[model samples]
Target chain A: MALDFTIIGYIAGTLTTFASLPQLIKSLKTKDMKGISPYFVMSFTTGLFLWLIYGLFRNDYPIIIFNIISLMFWIPLLYLSLMDNLKNKIKINIK
Target chain B: MALDFTIIGYIAGTLTTFASLPQLIKSLKTKDMKGISPYFVMSFTTGLFLWLIYGLFRNDYPIIIFNIISLMFWIPLLYLSLMDNLKNKIKINIK
Candidate 1:
């Protein structure tokens, strides 16, 4: 039963951790991120960073591992979203 | 030291869990979910549900509480995104 729960926890962690990936892929392919909210990415990435620190302090392997992976995906997404937002602002200013 | 880590964990959990909220509010205000990926929501929600179950099995209160709140936000976001996607498809079909 304990092992079963561990399996479930890992699966859950995997799903949530990779959740941002599809959006990242879509944004990369289209180079269009008009609909993605910059605030969302910023908040999430910050959260993930803190989670990593928390995991380290607590010595929680699952939290540490998954959040590291989550950060890998989200940091890029956050960068893209910020860049896209900046581009849009510049375009608006130029116009 | 342990208490400090607990504080960090809660803060991290709160930030990550509520990360989707800004997007949800944006979508609600503008009714524009075009940038929001349906796949992301679907995957994230599934992960949250599983996490909730995992929390229950592990008797982890923080996990259960945060995931439940995350679901409250995400489920609505998921519904809106699906509805928007459907509307877009219908519009395309009519054209």
Candidate 2:
């Protein structure tokens, strides 16, 4: 319950938030999601959203703030990945 | 602050942890990490470790437990990704 430890949690959450940015840039730049797993994307996005809700319930500012920001980073990637998956599926069907 | 809310946090944590497993299974089965971003994996793994530490500092069992378990899931993917990236680098150097 020390204030210092909560600071550490904030830092950890920040790193987790930062870590996803590069991947987002990569996804946006390449527009390639073949290597991206949709199931994970869907699950991760949903889970983070749930975390945001959990944060709201607990009034945990760090959790709410980080999860929402993380969701912002993730949503586009999820959209792109789903689009790619759908396109690939269509291609396979056509062939 | 409420017990029910903490339970929700636990569920969120579990889902976040679970989200990575399918990705791990795919990585193991296909041995393809092209879509897997190493930056995220390393940062996430380190962040989770920090979260574990944060948990210890706060004496919060859930934070410690989920992060350690999440580490177990992420480490292999990180190793595989670094290996794949290294292989590609070596291939480029040879060519």
Candidate 3:
């Protein structure tokens, strides 16, 4: 039963960690980020960073590993979203 | 020290759980989900559901509570995105 729960945790972690991947790929391909909120990207990345710290303090490998992976995806997403938003603002200003 | 770590955990959980809010609000206001990936929504929601189950099995209140809240935000987002996507497809078909 404990093993089963552990398996569930790992699976859940994997799913959540990679969840942002599709968005990242799609955003890169389409270059359309009008719908991706910059606030969401910022808060999520900050949360993941905190989770990594929490995991380190707790000495929980799963939390640390999964949050680390989540950060990898989210950080790049955050950067892209911010840059996109910046470009939009600049375009509007020029107009 | 332990209490500090617990605080970090809660803070992390809070940020992550509410991370989707801005996106949800933006999508609703703009009716623009073109940048939001359907795959991301589906996988993230599924992962949150699994995390809730894992929390139940492990008797982790924070995990259970946070994931439940996250689901509240995500499920609606998923529904809205799907509906928007369907509308777009229908429009394209008619064209």
Best by DockQ: 3
Displacement of residue A1 (Cα, Å) in model 2 is 9.1
lDDT of 2 by residue, A1-95 (tens): 58889789888999888889988987888786776678989988988988999989878888899998999999998999889989999999999
Residue pair clashes in candidate 2: none
Clash counts per candidate, in order, are: 0, 0, 0
Give candidate 3 regions above 4 Å deviation: none
Candidate number 1, chain A TM-score: 0.92
Q: How does each model score on lDDT? A: 0.88, 0.86, 0.90
The candidates' DockQ values read 0.75, 0.70, 0.83
Model 1 ranges with Cα > 4 A deviation:
B92-95
- The per-prediction CA RMSD against the true structure, in angstroms, equals 1.6, 1.7, 1.4
- The sequence of per-residue lDDT tens digits that candidate 1 reaches over residues B17-92 is 8877887787778777777778988999999999999999989999999999999989988999899999999999
- Residues A1-95 of candidate 3 have per-residue lDDT tens digits of 79999999989988888988898899889978888888988898999999999999999998999988888888888888899989989999999
Ranking by DockQ: 3, 1, 2
The Cα RMSD of model 1 versus the native structure comes to 1.6
Model 3: CAPRI class: high
Candidate 3 all-Cα RMSD:
1.4
Candidate 2 lDDT score at position B5 = 82
Model 2, residue B39: C-alpha shift (Å): 1.4
Question: What TM-score number comes out for model 3?
Answer: 0.94
